[model samples]
Target chain A: MAPRIDTPGAAAQAVDQIQQLRTRISRLQESTPPSMPLETHPALAGLVQLRAGAAYSVDSATLALALLAGPSRSGGWCAAVGVADFGAEAAAALGVDLGRTVLVPDPGDQWLEVTAALVDVAAVVLVRTTGRVAPQAAEKLAARLRKRGAALVAWGEWPRCEVRLTTREPSWRGVGQGDGHLSSRRLVVEAHRGSAPPRRGALWLPGEDQTYRPERAVPVAAPVEGVA
Target chain B: MVVWCPDWPVVAALADEGLPSHLPAAVFHANLVQSGNAAARSFGVRRGMRRRDAQSRCPELKVYRATPERDSRTFETVLAAVEEQHPGVAPLRPGLAALRSPRRVRGGETAAAALLAERLVELGVWDPRLGVADELFTAEQAARQASSQDCRVIAPGESVPFLRELPVESIDDAADGGDAVSLLRRLGLRTLGELADLPAAAVRDRFGPRVAWVHRVVGGAGAVPLSTRTPPPELARHVDFEPPLDNAETITFSARQTADRVVAGLAAQQLVCTEVRIDAYVEGSDDVVSSRHWLHPRWFTAADLVDRLHWQLQGGFKAGEVRAPVSRVLFTPVTVVPDAVHADGLWGGTDERVQRGIARVQGMLGHEAVVQPVLQGGRAPRERQALVPWGEKPTGLRPAAHPWPGSIPPPAPSRVLATPWPAEVVGTGGRPVSVDARGAVLGEPARFRPEPGDWMPVAAWAGPWPVEELWWEPGGRRVARFQVVGVDGRAWLMTWESPGTWWTEAAYD
Candidate 1:
């Protein structure tokens, strides 16, 4: 037995039911504290996408500052914990709003407590630990970050991070044997997420023009034999 | 009724310096004498005399800088004493105050004035004078004429004739700039009687409005009413322990109620305190053993106050541990503003939840541990940045707008070492490189070691950029700086001193 020809009214009613069911499925997906947009530097747009309620581990201080600059420029508060050697001017130059930034230079034995407190308020928190973090402490902080909808950028090793960024093959320009000053630097940034193959991108982590952007390919010189 | 204390500035300055009142003293503002004591006046040092001339007149004179704050602060006690007798007292200036004529008191006006004078004597006012009249101007004039610790009462309707005989200089007290008095004297009007005798229209046309007003007052035609002042409400709170508490936790627990009361008191007044001064007194001591002023980015809550008390008792960075058991603790609001000024916007302002969170961390660590970074003008990376304790307003920062010459061109270092690490830079043949007196590099730096062991050849290097800072001061520094990049591609800012020592100051990581 087969169904007869459908009327216009029945077709519209079917579309409405399908729409309602789709919305319900989306709501169910959102029950796990849906991820929100976290600003990432334009130079790293394709290389990485920072999401709220996630922890990202970084190898260098400059990388941490670069990640902090994104949210800070968009008018969000940021904090740094146990970063005794924080370079405030450099952060400012990278577009981080110093007015909205706070620092706990030395938390001593209370680093975890201090970082957790700051995480409750700031949109992004950068932490530099003196020693390896315990797995239990990291898990506890991860849950808090998820609950608060804040992102974490660890300057050192962090357990089970969403993404790990490390700088490699750094080459500085604008200096000679003893003449010019140290100016710009070009580095290969490798982004690793879970077990996925690591993505590599070349960037002028501040090019000679004092802007962070993807490095353009240098035109290869014509072969000597072909030119002759 | 008006009460006047003569040479109050000199008196207050001497008392503050713990100097003898009988000794000659003068308060100077802008190098000119603002006030002089009796002893200084006897030495020919008068008001408006240059500080040099006053010093020459009396070699042993105690000189003090004029501070209006000191004068007003010391005068607060006197005002309180006067208010005890008469509630609505008007303070005219640092040295003068007025109140409504207390004519129908237990005793007449004279008896009331005598009682006030007696109270002033206890507060160490050597010469306090009082006067009573129907109007404020006349009362002030009469007070100046009264003898030490005495009252001059002008009978009703006798203000005109009583004021007529006084010198034109009497009007100098009313004219803040003293221009009218000088003009009156230059015009040969010697006394209030002569000035009063002149036609009102002519005084207005030639001598100006101020002189005309003086003329009207002297003729008893214009009588200005006094504006009495209301007493300020008490906002300070204190808690005393039955048995002195040595444990910080117990002391904080005891002070919880007082902290709540302090916040509730401000809330009742429709105000919020932004700065509070906390004083902790130890057992068997009258003076405060630990005193600190705590500031808040926003208004303080009761819990915030209690946290501050605990941190103070637990020994903050500047305030070391409380030496003895705490007997009492006091909280005084240093700065407050209307609550309406800080009302949250319709869309809300900076997150209040964030403030609470940061404050929680401040409670965990000491207050100084949380800091806000600020940039200021300087040559070195470390000097260019300042770390202000969280919640404190940054003050006395060097202006960054001014072009600081000799500062390294931007692409600033990423990591500025909190403490410079000892490094070594060697030239060819592994000899330490040094800078000459003229800032010339004696030999080119070839190899460098940022830490103790590992040595790497320099990939690129520049400078011996010399800086001579505060050369005239005893704690001056004279050093040459260099930017060196190692083979590993990590750049470091290094300093070279005279003794062939190299130190790494920062890293361009």
Candidate 2:
């Protein structure tokens, strides 16, 4: 013998509350879908985020391969556009899936159109710019990129890019005089962003084992006098 | 059952060139007469005659190059015409197709053939013949005997007697048909009956599987049913703009829906488009404004189709050229491959998001910008690396599996210089390091200078591995290779040829 409320208005009010509850439950479930784990290397730990709709500019193809290696190994599609002379074997040895990779060695003046089309499928696109891009064209391309959630790894300058990375003072190892083949290389990667303090890290572009690894300790160069 | 169009190659050639059948015509393959029209045959221009002999027989013989493409293209229409009369037409070859006896199509086999003949005549084929029998082999023989515009049918169970007197060459096996018949004749087996009468086991032992199969086929013991060819799927996907859009963005926006439809059509057939042919018609005109081919690295998805459409439309008009407003855009998948061949790998190839990202980038940049590396054969490291467009298989590349002569052994250099850096290698007496013709080091190498740097003293050096390439041709190359280790514990690969100068071709790292 709870309170007896037998009116059409009361019934309608109860139905409304139930409908409201159902909508709330659906919204909660929709907003909280399970998130996927991001695939990134320790060398580029915070510099580039996987699945983040952002453009990154890098100086060296070695670092570009290093950055793409993580996504490629984790079952992500990577493409190189207009970078005809990119070192593909190094990329393959770095664990990028050669089968999953696409290379457009040369795409002359119609680069912008090509890049926009590429974002429709490839997860990461590495493009080497040969000419300047109009501001309007860049804006349109960037907008589409953000909408599609595709990452751009520009070899040269890009308009309003999110991250700019550069590699300097690369030293080759495993060669003596005219003997032995080049086995590894060491480089320092510095990342800069708007108003953010630049971050620096040492990397083995391709270490002795032909893989991108964080440099354990910087090697000391012998003094010039000691070279005798 | 067999549907044979007499002198199809000649007929096809004549039709393609708009030549009247009243004129003598011959189609030659490899300079040997393949097919001759009735007019040419009347002039003693027979099949298997050399081109010169045929021309001697009929000086006015319209000599047309034997183009298989034109013949096949014309034959497709014939296939379609026959297909209209009956479904599941199994094309045996150009101008030849077969189907199961459609007993009820127009009352009986003869009636069906007559109907097909009537339809083919309507399609400009003058003399199409049809043959029906209990099995395919006898039916083909029956068709060969039928004259122009005629249909023949051998009653079931009567093929054995009918085939008994036929020549042994009637047993047609693609690989060794002619040779087997010749061999049978040499063995004194002249007729199909004589060849069929031989012991099956004995014939199989003597002639092999192909001839044995042919023997069984001629004896009416083996009957292979006609395998109906699946008709190619229709692939034209089009969109018409109501206002005849001039802006690239607007045109592409409308194209997205059409692209989805095209992809859906392909998916329904369990196929994927590898290449697309697009034809855009101008507003208020029937003429096609632009026609182009677009290749894809992977199977085209809806988004990929849209991107390609957008790219093509934007680049359709060249600089300083008057642009045409696109009234209708038609996308046809010119080439399709089975989906089973391109299904995703065990570890889903690439993330869907990643694929879209790369595709978007390619659209903005251009088609040739993105590339994937493929291993190829060559003596040098640079030559070994080949780039293929993403999603496309590498083709026409030197096989990497072959053992290339004079190629450097494995643990190959990690880095290769695009252009070899010229360097100096001096011996103890300061003479340039050289390799003699006998592949011997001229002198003990002392110091190596790479780009005027501090001369690093060579701690140890390997032999001069000589390479002589293209020796039979002019401008051949002869070079000697050496692996040198410096006092600083670094290694480099150096090469020297005639007029010796050590060039640093690659580094260990």
Candidate 3:
């Protein structure tokens, strides 16, 4: 009394047809939040804040390490692309959970492609652009990064970045003559934005003993109670 | 009931090479013959024979290196074929498998076995054999006896008599871990009947528990229980194309559904796959075009599976290369773990979005591009941490708990210099500070100069802790470490290797 099973392969084909439809539907229904916000760094307080769908620039590796460490330690995924000279030890020292960090030491000619791919996965992507990027390519990558809700940490220059950190007058500490070690350095960091006077502050790039500590006012010795 | 494929390693190796089964083929492992086909065996090529000797016996024998993967993959296909008829077919090994005795057919056990042999033949297997008995041991013996027929059945009580005529060597290998058969032969017990006739307690005391097990098996007194396991449905999924499309996009697109189904199946069973074997087959052909085993950090998702396939198609797979892509794709989950143990912790582990993002990036870049940091025990800051690919369980590395003598004490350095920089330490008279062989400081270190900076006097300095490593070796090294604090409140861990040579190892924040 049952309808004749048409071609023996019909059942299999129908199963395949149903599966394709399901995949398409599931993909369409998938929607991710526009951005995954990261907590702002204390040192870069007023100047830099982490938000996906935008680009941020940093001048020093030490600041970049500090900026990345904050989010990464809180369980965000970070990636470094085409930054061949990145010091893994320095990143680790600054509290960047290297466990959550991905490094593409060299992306060669596929820097944009690599960055684009990284944007889809990593919450924060640090790209060291080697040369001038085509305006079209940059626009496309920026749009993709925005759509994916990933922040791009540009090592080199980037146009219209949400925040730009530039280090000036860097002074090394701890070392004297050629005998001691370079323990830390103090840098005056200037944050620049569109049509805004650059905000400047002084802090140890990596404070005394390889830490990112805000510059503290050294208590004046108070004339040492007549010791002189 | 047991169904066994004899010399399966040779069969599988030959099948992989597209060689005829009738050829005089013998597989070798480590220069010794492992399994030889009937054609090679007839020419005196035996198991464990040295290659040169086997070659002497059969000059025209085609030799092959052992490949366990091929054997396993082929046997898995055999198991799949058998599972179609008998659901709970438990694989004993690559060449041997057992199943629960089926309900009697119109022609009884022989007819049932004939049907099995017929099915194996249809799958291109020649001279397949089957045996049925109450237990696995006697059933295996029945299968061995059925070598000349399609099937053999040992009636319930006939197992003892059937086993009696056989040599004691027959039951020897299974029970005793060693060569119990040879020992029994040395003891003048040629037939299994003689071995079985011995008092059970005497056998147990003389030959240990294993021999006692053998006596029970042969005497038909003990039937070891069979662990009947059926392959889970989620273990495999396959899709076929009518016209055999060659386009990678189309093939992968079609495979997405199958992958999703496979993953969903595991999820339904509260399991997740850690490893999976993907197979691609050309239209109308049993020969696999490409096959690969992908390892995952966590359970595989549909997208992860699809990404791996696409990567492979785009030249990621080099060995057993997929020269032509047409027809069908099969995904087989090889390793799986329970889902209960894998659930993310509350507010601790990565969220689903994070997992997705990382996987996407890894897929785009390459598998090894993303790495996670793991703390490991070591003497120096540089050696204290290791980087492992994200998602993989960290293994095969030094444990962090081991107490490393001479390692820096608490208040671990905030950052470690990947490459140590050279520096110099001088005393008050501008004398380059040095440590003597007896661990005594040569000078009171005063001025510190790491580079071309102005000389800064050391405010406070710690001991010259000398350490001698690998002293028994010719390339031994001795270094004296010192901690110095500058007026700038910067601390540096400096090491003096020789009289005038100093290296700044790390800075303590």
Candidate 4:
């Protein structure tokens, strides 16, 4: 549980908002609640962890995929895998406000700085990096984000954090679209913490009206950069 | 306490843009500055005279437009960079932003200024001039005197002495010279050094107590550091059309190009310009300036911009009107300002859509057709409102979220009523006395009558909301106004606000 304090100023307000979000996350299931705003809970929050050093041969990818397609009897928020492709189909994700997304430049000297700035701003931060971040810096950033009432949906490999999660590639059946457009692609994705896994259910292309009816599936890679 | 924040990015970008086109891009100072001594002044060079003119006059005036913005931004960056190394630094403005959290010692003021200048050179900011003093004004003066990165601290006990070495006029030598300094200069205290040397008795005797207080500036008194002013909300960008693109296609194309430049510039400033000045040149005559002002109370879209420039195309010399085909089209930013998001946060801080809609309505009906109400400081309705200039930086106009009291609401609009129809009325006693629409017994209402047919109220109303407009002069509207209640429960804000002759000024919408 997040600690409560009686401090004044912007930091205190940020802490209170985040704590409120953490407490509100209890009611959510496997699917996004219809007509509900993000004010209600941390349905989309992701707990990203990292190892001490940089290496690519870790099971993090499989672990992430398993989490995205994990089995949960309860329907809930889609396990979105964020990527940096502007032209990718995930640009039109259901229940996601695309305008809130931010595109960061590659991981050079300014990457960590930019990521830290983006912590409170973006819905998801797709960092294109091949190296691990220092432990203290990551912890500081996570604390800042949580306090700001925002979540860290981190892409790119990092060692570890304190949040537990569940992972699996649950089975999928019923693969078809009502209209002529071919839809539905099978893929495994991950989630952190003891949260239930995402089923292999299909997410449809968000139409002009912006609804996610799960009507069809299209072939698209996970939208996150430097990920599986 | 004036502060100058020469937008370094803007200055650098403009200077860079001017370079490819072979134009000299320097923000040169006016007289008394460049020529610190008598010799250059003998050559007839003034501070702000055009460079070529100065060059012709002095032949070696060392005429250089200042790179103040470079010095300024560099100064700020260096301060930040130094702050990163040493914990706390207090900042003063105009190339001398500092922090006194943990000051550098052993003559820390000078040493720190020098250290910051060194950091600036490392960052590739030019000339690294540094000045440190007890106050912002004197610190800036000290910095200007610095030829290189070495620190020049105005000694704590020696501030008056340090400032006295400079001329008294330099006290008001700020970017936008305040009038107080000018009045002081007119009183003939030529140099600050001289002024400080004068005795207080003599100083106050001839100059008076009010002028005496201003002398403190010459004495280098400390003041709260002034902040850099917020940027203006207007757009201006000049385009140099090469190959003399006089065709309509080229001009319209250039408009879009320059519009993009302005939009990009606004984004960098974190603001927008609701007005733009479009200039077109016939290319050969030399410095032919033709321009018009475009304004909106809100942001305009690319289409709105295209339309205005389209009207402007009629004025542009199309292949037929010039000795040389029109080679260049330019847009100069007159004013650009930050969009004040509603205090309520209804739009999530981006109201571009609403602004664009206003632009369209203004464009179609008329730019003057729609207006947001602003309370001018006057009692009369016309005097109550002066037109609002576009790209006006949001300042003290609307003091708070509350509506302006004793001021009429806007959208009463811009049409003059046809005539003030008069009326005469008989009271319940059926006597031969006259009553105005307001039911006050008057001589007569000039052109109106009570109708047995009209189903309006006959409630007794008060006499004149009297107003006198230019009544002392030969001709003016002296009128009175009052409120009348109808039998149907409708109340009208009739004008007795003006004295005798009456016109309904406004209604509660």
Candidate 5:
């Protein structure tokens, strides 16, 4: 039998101990990564939640940069592997901290090793594979990523990913036939997860003000069909 | 004591050109004679004479460009020779050096000077002169008065008298004393004795600080004590292979100890090396077969140095198949700073874990393969970004804040192609779209092929934003940029070169 003291200090101490135990128990469960509030771009906030120890794939370079900018803006280190055509100015303009970004433009045949090594340090890593990665290599990298509690954003197809983001129905706002320059773009971003219906949202990839934000309630017109 | 080798620039230049010392040679800078050798001086060539005038005076004068670096590099041997005789040698210039008079030598100051002269003569400095006196200024003047390979000794108490008898023009040797020397000459003070007789305060008020200081020194107030330079410690280390190791792995494995020694030596002095020069000497070569300078973002440790050695060896040899067996490998610390500059902050700096991880990756790929992205100002997307290799500082980057007039507007392209892809754009009648020399659009682009065969109709388009870059120089380009959006919703940055060639520079995916 436990003896409880009728004191305010004892009651508070008991509460603290219970909270500590709960956290410990949560940590002990290794099946899934504990969800933490990862800083996501406001334009992608409600559509999908970025969790630690997960792999996310994006079809467009802008979306990859957006995902990377979330962790980088919050003062986390980021790395890009095998992305020879990474546009640094665009990344910086989109709020990615260039100072904390390490880039391996061409990893040659060692892309997997390089990405795995970077995962141990950087909060988020974006990789562009030269060819389709083997299943075993992907599985191995996933385990390492979970253990290190870092996220991976693949620029191309991956064997298995927690979320897959693709940009569709893109339209330029201020461009016309030999007139004004490209000012902004409106794109519909779809996030697909396993067995669940994909989440769709409309956003200005870069609004005319150079800030990314969700589009208003106005419906976008159908894309103009092109001659194939 | 002062050791003076006159006309050092001309001497060093002639030696570098492999010309005989007896030939008339003059070192010129900005078309004016900076220094002339004795042979040129005898032919009426003087410092500050125009190149044409000097050539006219002596048709055979060998005019070589003046390089302070060459002069100093040649003087290093002379300095080392003097330092071998006496430890505290202060180099005043390329040709002049000062040292404390060695009064304790067997033949006193004169004998010590003679000993140094003999050493300089061995180094091909045929006319090295030495002087001993009570102060540095007097000693330097005395050295000038001394004959070739000789010594001039001004007895301790006789410095004042010795300086007084010198001409007022002698003051010009002091830095920024030219105007004062001229003023004194204009005032009819031909000898330093006349200048020294003036009241100290009057000279101080009239001739400025330099002349005032000279007056005080000439008035028998002793000059400041010599601030002797401490000799640099020997931090370079080398390892020699037994029987000349042909295998790269064996060479680096053996060099591990030398690398450790180099780092430890630096640590002993509470310093760290940021730049190191590694040289591998092949068995049959008199010079280094492979030499490269490796820079570290922070300071290097022993392990980093070994990795650099391994990489250097591997890079110099194709697939580790050495062309010539490596006999010796040397490690030289090119740049070192105190460890305090790199000490960890209270909350620690960049995560050491990240540094280690990046280093491991650098081991897998070459160092240049790992880079840090940086933004810079330019008109083109490719020019706006710079990739600095990992563990090296970015240099010569254009500032981004400056307004670039012809630059593309914001909403920069996402994927800046490493190399521009050749492309084709056609108008309504299958005519190739082009931009004329005056930046006029030849035809409205309707369909484009960004790749080899994939054609897409242009959904929206803008520009022929014309830019004439580096037009006055060779290889200059006259390009007109265009922003074209395809039906697939991908936008491309295309440039139309004169005479109808199109290239896709970047894509907004």
Candidate 6:
């Protein structure tokens, strides 16, 4: 029984927040920790350092895909923000506990609820908004997410939430064992934070039978000893 | 007359299908609380049938008032008593029950049957019957005869005598007025035991060989074995708070403690609830104030459950007012599935991986808070979105980006600019912001500059897009908005010359 924070006319409420409102958020960043960058879990390290009382936003699907690749427990603690029901297919695909994942009904103040929910969830998968939010609502919600140690991710457009990740549709080529269907897909992604250069790699969806495998770092050319 | 349980497992499955709980005398339910009309229709009550429908189904079709608590209590008791006797009871329905036992024992099963009958009577069941048969099919039939406080024991070999006397109608009633009875009646078979009197060949010749089998069953002949099942776990305890708790705090505390106990029970088996239902009622308010607490699958913590109670009792819910002090509290796991997760493998597999993933969410969004829009039922696009429990998955993942062709186009701001700001849009670049005959205006306007902001010089912008909405009403399509981006690194979708001035449309995010 959460406090029923009815964001009455949240769209209208947030509409007032249009762009003038400013937001102050302390970010949770993934650092190398003076050790091996390879051994470091960037997503996890960054997640734990998140400030508890702030509000922020991120990409929902991207976060989920990243989580699927990284270490995580099941019971679907991750939440997708939207008014519609995301069933077993998506939950299973995301590899979270289907039971634990929640669907927030679409209330007018999607921004406000997204903001409010930010404080409670580790990550909020916002179905990228097609409609515009009141600038103030966006600021207040972002401010709140920053304080709450929660993260908001916009699924379609990353910058809208001020945070983002990039993953393109994977192309697969293979038939899966189940029902003789093709399950292979190939995907390429480049994840970047703030202004960091994107971490690039190829992802292979091994026909549903095998787990997703990411290719190792694409090497950057280092100038040879004598070469200018 | 199969009344749907509606306990998550039941209610969510009604897919524009026919109602199951209907037949008057048997269990009928359009919903858990009983759809008497649905029941009436089945009992010869047709469409447009009224109260007279009740009598048509079955005069004695006992309308057992349903309270989820009562159904649960009855189920618990039924399961308990069945387990107590044979140590093997598999639950069937909320208000109904079943138990399994082995057959063909060197020592006759009569002893087991007698023991079960005695226990059922002792456990507050009215009249109990003990049945001993090689087949479960016969055992169920034997129990049917034992319903009237009379101990009717149908031994394995003596089923002929036991079933021969019972009318075909009895078998139909026992099956909740389902199939077998009607099929048998159509074949002209009057009693269960009469099959024993018929010749196998003759029975088969008339009923396509299936009759021979029925004849054998009716004659109580053949060696049928039983498939025994394990009994359900028994974890019941009673507690009476000394001072009746009349306030929400007291009730919440009790609920919290109760939640601990519930969690402990599940944890012992390494399980967590996908759903937990909390039943709370005031001590003296038994007649009026009783509330049911529904938690989303994400509300797994003790705090979560307690918070749910606090929110409900302190206010007026659909169930009405919390008028009385709730003296008793019943916490049941409406659903407790298991959580079998493999540990993280070489690649940060399990929990660690999850934390990282969550961190990414929190890092960007700013916090760990997650919620969902819960309320639906709206006609407007903005009105349709409702915030619900965080961590919940979205039902419909609507495509996030779309080009509003007829209206102001994007590369628009992700945010809807605030309105009623008291502004003036003095320039429209000589393109009157009006809807044309073909509903098309040549590139509405390429740009604009705000009052407070510096004048926009460069024009790397697009659109004087025209939009008309709700054309039915006079002046319905109120604002003819446009998309304008200034060369000064700023972009906006502003409604030029509307009810008020310069209402900024959107930002590029």
Number of the top lDDT candidate = 5
Instruction: Return the lDDT, model 6, position A88.
Output: 26
lDDT of 3 by residue, B405-486 (tens): 7665543444455567888899988899998889888888888865457777786677666778778999888887777766
Candidate with the greatest TM-score versus the true structure: 5
Model 5: lDDT to the true structure: 0.88
True contacts kept of 1: 0.80
Stretches of candidate 6 exceeding 4 Å from the true structure:
A1-228, B1-81, B90-147, B154-156, B160-194, B197-202, B208-210, B218-220, B227-257, B278-280, B286-335, B342-396, B399-481, B495-505
DockQ of each: 0.60, 0.21, 0.11, 0.01, 0.66, 0.04
* lDDT for A132 (candidate 3): 72
Q: By lDDT, is 2 or 4 better? A: 2
For candidate 5, write residues B456-508 as lDDT tens digits. 99998898888998899999888988999998888999988876789999998
Higher-DockQ candidate of 3 and 6: 3
RMSD each, Å: 8.2, 9.9, 13.1, 26.3, 7.3, 18.2
What lDDT does candidate 1 reach at residue A224? 21
> Per-prediction TM-score, please?
0.78, 0.59, 0.61, 0.31, 0.79, 0.48
Looking at model 6, residue A174 earns an lDDT score of: 29
Specify the poorest-scoring 10-residue window by lDDT in model 4 chain B.
B409-418
How far in Å is the alpha carbon of B381 misplaced in model 5?
A: 2.0
DockQ of 4: 0.01
What TM value does model 5 have?
Answer: 0.79
lDDT of 2 by residue, B1-509 (tens): 79888788889888988877778998888898878988999999987799999999999998777787887899999999877778898988887888888887657887788888889888889988888988887887888888778888999898888888888777653546767777888989888888789989998998778778767876778788678988877877899998788877898898988999999999898999998988888877888887778777568888877877776777776442227778899999988999997899987655676666565555566544556677788876677787665545577899888988767654455446657888988999788988777777787789987545788988766656678867799999778877776765455678887768788876553
What is the Å distance of residue B14 in model 6 from its true position?
Answer: 25
Ranking by TM-score: 5, 1, 3, 2, 6, 4
Residue B465's lDDT in candidate 5:
84
Docking quality band of candidate 2, CAPRI definitions: incorrect
TM-score (0 to 1) of chain B, per candidate?
Answer: 0.75, 0.64, 0.65, 0.39, 0.76, 0.56
Angstrom error of the Cα, residue B465, model 1: value is 2.7
Sort order, lDDT high to low: 5, 1, 3, 2, 6, 4
How much of the true A–B contact set does each candidate keep? 0.80, 0.37, 0.19, 0.00, 0.89, 0.06
